[model samples]
Target chain A: MEEAKEGFEPKIIGFTCNWCTYAGADLAGTSRKKYPPNIRIIRLMCSGRLDPMFVLKVLLNGADGVFIGGCHPGECHYIKGNFYARRRIAALRTILKQFGLDDRVRSEWISASEGDKFARVMKEMAEDIKKLGPNPMRDKIL
Target chain B: MKGTELKQEDLEGLFKGLLDKKAVDCLVLPHKVGNNVAYMLVKDGDKIESPAASAIFAPSFGVNAANIVKGWTIPERVGIVAKPCEIRAAIELIKLKQMDKESVLLISADCSGAFTNQDYADHAGEIGDWVDSAKINELKGKGIAIREACAICENRLADVGDIIIERVDGGKVLVAGITDMGDEALSSTELSLEDKDVERQAEKEKIAADAKKEKEELPKMSSVEELEEFLRDCIACKNCRDMCPVCYCKECFFEQPLGKPVGGDLLNLAELRSAIGVPTNQLLYHLTRIYHVCTTCVGCGACEDACPKDIPLTRLYPLIAKKVQEIFEYVPGEDAEEPLPFITYEEEELEDKLR
Candidate 1:
């Protein structure tokens, strides 16, 4: 019943691979790119290490959205980490679709050199999540 | 392609011959225990008796026998007779390194569906007589139905087993060897083996098609609120995880210290959310479990049967598993050589699934 759409800032949990997205985020910050300061980044060695449970935990714990960033296909620093991550995130999204939360999570291939793309993705996700309103789980006692 | 047709009574002799000939050091099979039938490890040929050995063909299922045979590391070679689903679960376990494929022989049969444990125990006498006649259709006509999982089960025939027993028309049991080890074991028995074609594909397809239709007709949970509603009565006993044959973790993640919230953490969580469920993380527990098993789940419905609250879990897990499996074009327990979806991936695939 919270219909007030004035100045609602979505809280997003970003899981970024250290070799790619994490570096890209640092680059964005150094570049002073104007992206929403809504996301909290957790750097992992590889995207494959992002267990689906972690995303579920944060979402249920009241994070409004989740962002997953990894190396582009065939470009994982560990050879095939991003490939596995893609499969896992895809499967996770399929499960989330059943709960009407699929749109609340996003996965992208943002490399270390794509600071602009990384910042752009953050801004776009923040805007999209704002339009989606607060995550229903935010107020839920689940 | 060696097969032999024999009466139901002849099955006991064939199994006993395996023990007498030392084809197997032990036989893991279903036997009548007091009033209920349970899986037993029989070491001697004399221990294999009539009506008891026939319990394998009975429409009574208590647990997935794969759970019983998991982690068997003895030097003795064992032959395990089980339903098709149980065999499939065992195959998944073997692929997961939870069970050793070389250490045991997998014997599976054409399952004619099965009743839940309570139903089987209540009608054990009548069901026993019906099973002896090898007329499975008669039980349905008499208004005794199989469990929903069994009824919707498409993998009724064992395709991946080393040995397969087919119950054909006229109470005739046709035992065949599909693998090299299976042939060697069959050769030791006195029953003469000949080449025979098992033309059950059409029947199997029909059953699968019917099951698909039935599944499509069941109502689905489309949102988190609906899912929570469906699991409203769950007491968080974790029986479903315990009953699940593929949930083979030595220490489940939910049981770990990190998964448990202390009193202070609970208070903080309640304060943050303004309120919290008493059991706490009921949704998290089920979601994490379903996600964990989505890829490798055999859709055996053991979790549903284990639920004390009578939540229709079969409606959720198996259906979700079916969709997820379809996305990857992977069937759990179908092939040993196929890599697990989570462990292996292709460079250019599932593009539509990503943002």
Candidate 2:
């Protein structure tokens, strides 16, 4: 009985773009779609708008993982904003990895029509986060 | 440092002589902006005028002067008056290939310190009139003279300048040559160089010691949430960008047409906020800014000074810049020969990342 400890459940923070990912999540809800409930969605207007600091902030505050869902490249309502976001977050990921804190951060392309895709991504991300355990940023070593 | 023992008239006479002979194309000097003095380039033999003492210490003056002279392809050699930070910033700019230092002259004054605009307004008693070095020194002994950035800075003497006119040794300014260019300029002037290296070193140590104390006390937010909360007061004013000497982007990301407003859901509002004039990706903008210039940042404290909300943007940049520089073992402005991080990579050095 002592050897049988319960498995861990990861807390994932999803930053969803309002034009696509956020609408996808809303559609998933209205369609009564079933998905992992671990993801807590915070809707932003565009993926480009996410401050790389917010991900670090969320990770430090207690989220095990962060998911940034945005419109596909070239599909942004504001033209090249998502491209800029990609370039920015890509650099941020490199910087975090250099600091030994990159694995917990993830990004995906999702559209307003991709309700099922959103569900699958969330479920998979939750599993990966659970396997990865708590965010290393919480370790206080940095 | 609290009093002006030498009058501006004496300084003007010395500077006028240098300018008349075309000793330098311009003396990047100070002029009265209302009551306060900001940096202004005075061409050959022009009368120097100011209501108050200005910050000639900033390194941007060096860059601005260089940019003006070089960008315009002017044939004349220019002289610049700068603070220690300005000297450092200019040095960084040169290293980044953003500027060429061949035709510019640097003249740095003794830096007691500089006060924030607000500090000057609150303590100096009015903003409409010019506030100069004498007024600042009057408040120095009371621990209310300089800006927080100036207080925390370790460099008092302009390290990269050609000539340094410093007030040392019982208020007597000793003009000395820091480079060959300095020697050439001083060769023309009658100002004597006293062997006061010992005294100058002592002054330097005093500044370094004070800076060390402040540097140690700089807070690093333990949690991401705390950092966010600290930045929550950001009204998204681009004061930090405008005041940044190195943020020389022709057009910024936030100002571009591609930037979008954050979602209505995030604001917890009824509808999406309109996008015009609002900074859509505040964090991204800052990150991109730091990424572009992290190694070149001179920690001028101007960005923080310009912030209406007092977000301590300057404090954060230095911390991040230092980290980036250390990871790459790069000091931004130390020399011209050093290469930037993104421009070069070695297989042996990048093995960890590849694996």
In order, what are the TM-scores of chain A for the candidates? 0.95, 0.88
Residue B314 error, candidate 1, Å: 1.1
Model 1 over residues B1-355: C-alpha lDDT tens digits? 7889888878888889988998888888988765566788899989886764358877778888888877776667888898888888888888888767677788887776778778788888877733521344577688776776776777887666778888878878889998888888899876799997888888889879977876777787877889888989998889999999889888887777567676888788778878888787789999898898889888788888899999878877877887788889998877666788888877689878866
Query: lDDT by residue for model 2 over B1-355, one digit each (tens)?
Result: 1112334335565566668766787777755443244566788575665311333322122122333322323457777666656666666555555556666666666565666644554554432222334555556666665665665666766555676666434424455667766676765765554443524677578777977687777775543445445666777677787767766666776676443334543353222322222334554456556666666676667777777887887556765665566556765555445665545543224222211
* Candidate 2's DockQ: 0.05
Q: How displaced is residue B289 in candidate 1, in Å?
A: 0.7
* Regions more than 4 Å wrong, model 2: A1-142, B1-10, B32-35, B49-74, B125-145, B189-203, B257-279, B341-355
How far residue A116's Cα lies from its native spot in candidate 1, in Å, is 2.7
lDDT of 1 by residue, A1-142 (tens): 3353578899999999999999999899889998999999998999989999999999888788899999989889999989989999999888888888888899999999999999999999988888878877787777
